[model samples]
Target: MHAHFYAIVNQHAGNYRGYKIWQQIQEYMIQKDVRLSVLLSAYPGAPEDLAYDLASSLPDKESDVVVLAFGGDGTLHEVLNGLIEAKRHFPLPLAYIPAGSGNDFARGAGLKSASHWKQGLLDLLQTTHAQVINIGSYQLQENQPRRFFMNSFGIGFDGSVLKRANQSSYKNLLNHVGLGAISYLIAAVFTIFQTKGFPAKIHGLDLTKSYAKAYLMIVTNHPYFGGGIKVAPDAKLHESNLKFVLFQRHHLGQIIFDMLAIIFGGFQYHMKAVDNTLLTHDFTIEVNSGQTAQVDGKSIDQENYRVHFSKSSYPFWLPETINKKR
Candidate 1:
């Protein structure tokens, strides 16, 4: 039986879904046998800091302690990165309850139970074992510390659309109404046609290409992105290989078809405009200057940056679900 639980919560996630759920369940959790400590995040990066401190505070072999995260994928992303930064000799187990709009992490990680997080937490409370999932990491510059992601990373159109959706005031309204995904749809519709496209050079996984007008390039460790879209069907949680999928707008008609194929499914694999490559070893992706980038749904500013990609590991103490464990 676990003796203690450390909960890192991002209340603002899913437009207060995380906080609202936690508030309703905290009393019940406190009454349970396990000791519980809670930390609320005030802003971005707070969860990461809280996760680091919690991991550092635990003993190396503290098997009875588990860190529980309650938020969307972005919150989970920070918590995992924080644990990685702590650099503990042994991995610390984590449990998650996804309460965000685009729960791509939950979708990919086989935690659909998160939709009803109260039950999800209840199920997790009974689990005694944790499964270790291999995650993804990247570096914008050589010799720099690695940044990790559990879902996927994208540059060019994929990222630009997310940036616009996340920054738009309509996102707040949509999130408030539990229709946040609509923002992504609206943004995508406008971004695709407006994009002039950018250049890129990709090298790794026995597949190399240089594109003069790469509309979108994404590296995914799992199959789901953009709230449930199968962005890279070959990518899976248990698999060690990453899928680097790229798209080029050689012609307006062809580019529209590519985007439609991606959104509606089927024919993407056969399209000449789409390049889906399996990345087995370390890879380098150089994008055109002043491009927007995204990792696990967070925006980034990368200009002519050559990002390095690799692998990492995180131990997840998740409740068993119908989906295969990763």
Candidate 2:
């Protein structure tokens, strides 16, 4: 069990659960005699800066520290950016408590909290089995080489949806109305109506292919996105590869049916018109003209980008054995 814990919290996360979850985690850790440090992100880029500082200053002995992220995938994404900026070859392990809307990474990582958070903490503490999960890295064709992503990145329709979702004042209200899936639903509907799709050429794996027009192109290192939607059912974190799912131009009915299939977790194979495949290492995506790209949830102003896969053998400890043994 890790004796020391540090948490970087996004206070404005889904329904304001970030602080509440952090307090609960703190109480639980105290009960187990674990030392903890809590840092609340007051504004947008705070957590990333703090996390980078911490990662850069990690002790020489690789101090027993674990970072608990108390927000959605965006928070996790920021923490990852900070860690990468810190340039730690072997960064501290990450522990996630899904407190934000669209906790996609948490669902994909299988670390969603149960009815009680103490159980989650105990599970992390008691587990022994470990795995080294692969994280995808991407660089925009228009931007410098400083930016990369650890989660799913997208272009075209999905990126546009992300833009709207981030700007919607009704996002929180919708999340409260449902299990954080409402915002995505609303966004998807809007995107379907507004987008005619875009053109892109994608080369990956044995699937080096081109698209005359695509509704969206999503590159996932893990299975789920937009909360629990399994965008690519076959993507595995431990697998040394990436998965690409492209929705070609479709009619409104096809779009609606494909969205339904995605919600049901078999859209890739179920939708005959969908292009879904895996890439071993490198891939390039070029759009016809102007296109928006998004890494994690941040939108990038770019028309093209090249993704090169590399391995970061970070040690990840999980409760897989205990949870799966049942």
Candidate 3:
């Protein structure tokens, strides 16, 4: 059987490096004798729309098609939405080549540098390792239907950071110089200083736990976000559940101290006002009327939204692997 490669390039991603990286991928696939197709996103929202259309059209041929993403987490998020909309199920696999700022998803997958990323992609094609993993889904209370995400989603102060990050002029600078983490750090500090605590009702693995209002609530399928912050330290891709972590309300000094500890991987047990909780499955967050939430870095203004861990609901394709056991 032959393998087909579908490369999606977001020209605006990471200072317009998508096209250049796509060219390199195109050439590499040819060298490997892999069939190739290219999708160039012309503007914002184009990639998601295009991916959905392609998934709907279904390539005429039967050879496996691997969608190689060539941008940051946001680009992958868009592709995931399109694939989900196309009805891709869990068996469907996705590959990444980090070309954008804050390449957190790729970093978590053990593909840190360009050299390592290339090796990982080749391994996916040549090795005997492929596993179906669950992805997270979200839906607002009053908006359209439900949507899906492959990374982290949240509500509250951190959600506000994501919203502002999207609108930041620093994004261009971040993409150009690969300083996405620094940009997020500056924005987060600014956000924490100005944002006030808000009340939220959370229900998941445990509901009786009590505390003051939360700074934010995050549900994740992976361990990293905001570039490299381990938001949900125990999240795994193959798991059928989501990891829930809450930064409960506390004094500014305490919050700052806890955050510093978290940066060093030493804050998990320093529970004072609130615990760094973890959940394995579904969860809900109830906020005052007129609150907002963010899923995969995209913000939605809604009173509340319910997000959960679920198997992929579409027909997705994974790279073929060689077996050594046989």
Candidate 4:
């Protein structure tokens, strides 16, 4: 029962260290006598196209192929979308190696540290232990193409933070020093004073509500976001439900306090600022015109979106030892 490993490497991710890590992984595979191949992503969204082509070429029945994503959460997001687009009902088994600045998905999934990820990946490739996790989907309109996310989706405050951080020189500097999470915190502080609340309406699975001035709306599939912040402490990846956390228009001090709470694992104590926290299988958010949004830390230029949470069509391989610990 040999496995065919294909890694989709993101060359631009994580302080320009992807190529070096890929080389190490290739050498390790050679030493272990395992089959290995790689597809380098040349540009944004290239992983999706490559994943689609690879998945489409597979035989109808299950095979020994395993797709490994060697980038940040965004790379995994693109690859997942590509495989789902190729075959909605039965995508290939997937694995991941954290190699990006904000690896919230890896943290939430309890993956090994970056220094030890090669051994963790090798362990998965050598066995068939896999888990079925849920994926979140959203569309701006009923007729629009659906976008998938393996982590959290954010609007207003979170979107602004990501936009600012991506455009700032600090993020790159932080990445180089292996302190990428601090970049997001700095961006959030800068954006907090400048951001304004926007009107929003949320229609959840069991409740519907409206807000005249909403500062933040985060929908999460797991407990971590913004590089290991436990924003949704109770979220489970295997559950077919989405957890929503909303922060209405609040004072700068309150916002800062909440941010600190999230950073220091004290979010439960600051739940007063949270306008609503609910679990729903499906929901829709209508934001004021000109507002922004983000899906899995990537900014989106949209004011409205309908989100649906459901189990993934395929399973993903995880290191058995790590899975047991979780």
Q: Best by lDDT, which number? A: 1
TM-score of each: 0.94, 0.89, 0.85, 0.92
CA shift at 77, candidate 1, in angstroms?
Answer: 0.9
Judging by TM-score against the true structure, name the best candidate: 1
Q: Is candidate 1 or candidate 2 better by lDDT?
A: 1
Off by over 4 Å in 2: 114-116, 128-130, 176-178, 204-207, 303-313, 322-326
Model 3 root mean square deviation, Cα atoms: 3.9
- Model 4 off-target regions past 4 Å? 303-313, 324-326
Models sorted by TM-score, best on top = 1, 4, 2, 3
Which residue runs does candidate 1 get wrong by more than 4 Å?
113-115
Candidate 2, residues 68-147, lDDT tens digits: the string is 66777788788877877876756777666767777676666667452356766777777543456777776554355645
Q: What order do candidates take by lDDT, descending?
A: 1, 4, 2, 3
- Pairs in clash, predicted candidate 2: none
Cα deviation of 301, candidate 1, in Å? 1.4
Instruction: Tell me the tens digit of each residue's lDDT in model 3 across 1-326.
Output: 34466777787766775556556766877888777788888888877887788767774444366666667778888887876677633323456677766676664555644434566567655633344556777655535566787777777766777777767898777756656666667777777776566776667655534335677677777777776777666676655666677777667876776567666774555575445555554556666745457776667777644443333432223333422111
* lDDT score for residue 51 of model 3: 75
What global local distance difference test value does model 2 have? 0.71
Q: Write the per-residue lDDT of candidate 1 for residues 1-326, one digit (tens) a residue.
A: 76377899898986775577678667778777558889999987999999999888888775777888888788989999898889988868888888787888887777743346666777888788777776889998887889999988998887888889888988888877677767887888888777766889998767588998888889998877776767776677877778888888786777777777877884587887788888778889997678888999998986677999987777888766625534
Task: Look at candidate 1 and tell me the lDDT of residue 295.
Answer: 94
Shift in Å, residue 121, candidate 2: 1.7
